[model samples]
Target chain A: MPEITYRDAVQKAIADEMRLDDSIVFFGEDVAKAGGVFKVTPGIYEEFGAERVRDTPISEQAIIGTALGAAITGLRPIAELMFADFIPVAMDQIVNQVAKYRFMSGGQFTVPLTIRAAQGGGGGFGTQHSQCAESWLMNFPGLKVVAPATPLDMYSLLRAAIRDDNPVVVLEHKYLYTLKGEVPADASPGSIGEAKVVREGADLTVVALQLMLHRALEVADKLADEGINLEVIDLRAVAPLDSETILRSVMKTNRLLMVEESPRQGGWGASVASMIADRGIYHLDAPIKRVNMENSLIAYSPVLEDEIIPNAGKIEKAVRDLLAED
Target chain B: MTTDSIARLDRDARLKALNTMTTIRLAEEEIQNLFMANLVRGTTHLAIGQEACSAGVAQALRPGDSMTCTYRGHGHALALGMTLRAMMAEMMGKASGACKGRGGSMHMTDQSIGLLGANAIVGAQLPIAMGAALTAQIKGSGAIAVVFFGDGATNIGVFHESLNMASVWKLPVLFICENNLYGEYSPVRATTPIDDLAERAAAYGMPGVIVDGQDIEAVYSATLAAAERARAGDGPSLLELKTYRYRGHSRADTGPYRAPGELDEWLKRDPIDLLLGRMIAAGEIDQAEYDEMRGAIEKAVVEAIEWAQAEPFPELEAADDYVYYPG
Candidate 1:
């Protein structure tokens, strides 16, 4: 009934879940009085008291470790690491402990925790503050990684991650927080490991994750003017990849193009490409092309940063090259 | 509160404490033999001289309360009522083990017994214990979480984070640090600037108590008070058990770091012997009864080792089986 911004949708999802479940709590540096650096947690402390909406000390290791501890014990804690770049300090907890607890315990335990942080670079935050680490987390076995690009996806995915039994890493694009989209009034929280086909076409399938999905959609619209139809698939979740949906699309289009904001080497796009090559290689008429960030640190300068990341223009050109091949 | 209270314990509680310590001692002896005989694989950290802390604390806990332990966790697991057979089987990598042989000696766990796990990483269990306490608080289960770590863990950042959160939320947790004075090859003096680990708790605005870890009665009394305060929701307590480890940090360690006379000094204060002396002096048990208890525990330990050696290793294909991806 009402159009909400992506930031508001995230806040509403946490507020609603906190209302429904007393075990749900939020904690991060500056999250309490500041309501999050991006304001995604505004009014949460006022609504849920200080205990539920905790403001933790400036320790990423503790932020993640405390969340893991709280999650495994009983409470559902959504811990925010102020920025995605700061996650390296807590990688041991996220990768070794939180990700391996279920498997290590032979399914005897579950780490029902959610780690939310803003990712991506567009606001000239420099190399240290701007990073997309979803691919790094996807390498682990017991973790579920998600990055929501739209208001609807953000709300539904955040809610799903909070409710899931396994540990989840929700990478919210810092640049997309203010973007608005139409969300259904009564839309139920969506499932993990499913891809959403935002635009349908017959020529080629362009798979994108997080904010790149919006760029892919924009490129799909531009390519339509030239009578070149393109199918845009949004990879809502990374770890439990929707291989079936991706294969089905690849079988129809016979060409694949994956775009990601992470480094090209060992990026999540590599996994998708390898999956298609392994399962649906015979369905392809041309090679699968990937558009990703350069395999280097993000530059501090805006011009250099822009050149490092993949944009709609690059996705469009990659699709055209793949289609041009006989 | 009084010296008489320090010297006195209920008959059943004293027996339970002694039995727990005996179980852990025998279990460690069995594990050592099995490890040397090549029946069990992987590194092992034995809690031989540090039995009092685990036994005393575990004896104070109810069935529903939970515990998180460090690599030196055989005592913790055995004290929490995890069958010696399961623990031995786990070390031997058998499917009959508590974690279905997925976890080894340092990772032993029995959720049914409220033993969350024996984490290998130092100081890693602090936050986890806090989380479990948070769970207990939220569910109103009246349960508490006891975290067992070493003096070495005090230097780790997770230790501070866990303490801060535990005190801030007043979560039902008992942060027990077994200050054995050594963190692997390095002694605590070489690593930390503080003389007393208990004093560090004062920074977090909670009560910190240091007790004679080699005395079972002292450890039991201190832990009981801490557990009672936790259950009453008074807040978390930091109990520093001043103890010593008879063995090296791990199997690979030769323990050359200790002075020549330190081991003998600690052996004089053996917790099991102290408990036995008290029991005998009070006429709680005769020499014959003590011999029978010791014999039974020895028999159990022998059977556990035999069972573990007879067990088979897990199949290689099973390695990737439990990597969960909830579709």
Candidate 2:
């Protein structure tokens, strides 16, 4: 067992997989010599050398397309975008070329590429750099989207994403990079589309992911002392959602409250709420409530950023309001 | 009109090259007839006049080498050795088609022949080809990646990004731009500022050459030289083929926007006819042999259409297949 930061977990997962598989190559801006702009992947280049771990120009489209090209031709490539907001810059390569290549080619090809991008708002990276863009990619059927909230989940889920035959987008919350947790040496490469019940309680089921998961957990802890029991589930996989776990939890708790840092409209929470309404509507004792960021550009000020995005207070209020419902 | 390049090809090589160009020409013509008959569901882009570019480039590369072309890729797929039956079946959306009817005219693919895939989006294949080259570089596979696009694709941001990255990494790739004088309806001049699209290669620090696309020998020679350089680990190069499209952008476009004599002017330098004239001038074959070869090819193409049309459409449930690999 090792206590490691989420950032180190990502680096270690990539390094460990690259050692076992020569087919795995890492490419991104300043990821090699400069050790990544986030400093998350520093020693990989030294360990694997320039061929396995390489730096790329600031061309997001080329970075993604090259990863795709390499993936289809018998190599598993891991591409890192410096920021999630920049996902739009390479949207065509991701949504059209990478996502559709397998289906478009009638399964003649496989794009086993893992695209890692630092996402979420809190450190004041401004509108262009800070966006929880996991929802943007969930709309596509061929793509798998995962957001890891803890170091252990980050390590295990990323390894799973790399090993996946389909293209997987891993959104690492920027604020959680330094947050540390005990990660098992042989953390199982758990399957995607699986949710982790971080805390189990009886009163209500609180679903969240990435930074919002941490916030909801904190809210659940505070409310637990106040005689309110909350079952908090960390939705690690956003696409092909772990709806069974959610519906089962909703069945028990009879209430569902989703917390997310993305825009309210078309957010991950919105999609989950719609699904719950469709599948588990009769089981829910109250209307499904969502705590999401306002549909506005993330601002530079920390106050405005937190004000817009979900916080522990918002999660707590939503939880209490759901319980107070007749 | 005899150059040292055409002389390099012996009588058999010359006739084979002519046959490839003619096959592509006849196949494209047949596809047009299929479209007119309402057999092809969506639109199709026919490379009727750009056969030399496809034939020349395919001849230059080894069989294991990879290639990707634009939506107007019927010529490239045929040149790369995809069966006429598969191409025709794909156009007709039959289960026996190249992509098993999952992909239509725009997304034709035959992985067996190393035709990576044909992309419908403009300039989308550039990075994918670079990636394939990256794979070759990593595996030390000696294989190269060739990507073809229209002159309009050169203006795309990804096109520039792919070239810069490929050149920076010394990836084994050939960026072939078929400057067919138009990117859809607009002529190159109306859309692009530069006269020669190959000049864009200098910014990426790669050797960029312009070839007379109608001349199959010239295209083959230039591509072979570039491929050799790539195999030697020199880097990527951009090849601009000065060619034209006989038809409009897609099936419905009648080229009303083109200059009146533009189609006629390009037809005068038809790729298949240019190679045929070269072979005939060198006494490779007489007009009778050429006619007989074309007739046989036309007959084969017609039969392929019949076979493809007879094939069944894919099961409706197949839409869910291959979205993700079970593996």
lDDT of each: 0.86, 0.90
What are the runs in model 1 whose C-alpha is more than 4 Å off?
B1-7, B308-321, B325-327
Worst 10 residues of 1 chain B by lDDT: B1-10
- Please list all clashing residue pairs in model 1, or write none if there are none: A69-B131, A70-B131
Give the alpha carbon lDDT tens digit for every residue of B89-156 in model 2.
98888888899888889998988888989999899899999989999999999999999999989889
The model with the greatest TM-score is 2
TM for every model, in the order presented, reads: 0.95, 0.98
In CAPRI terms, model 1 is classed as medium
Cα lDDT, model 2, residue A274: 86
DockQ of candidate 1 against the true complex: 0.61
lDDT for residue A288 in candidate 2, whole number 0-100: 92
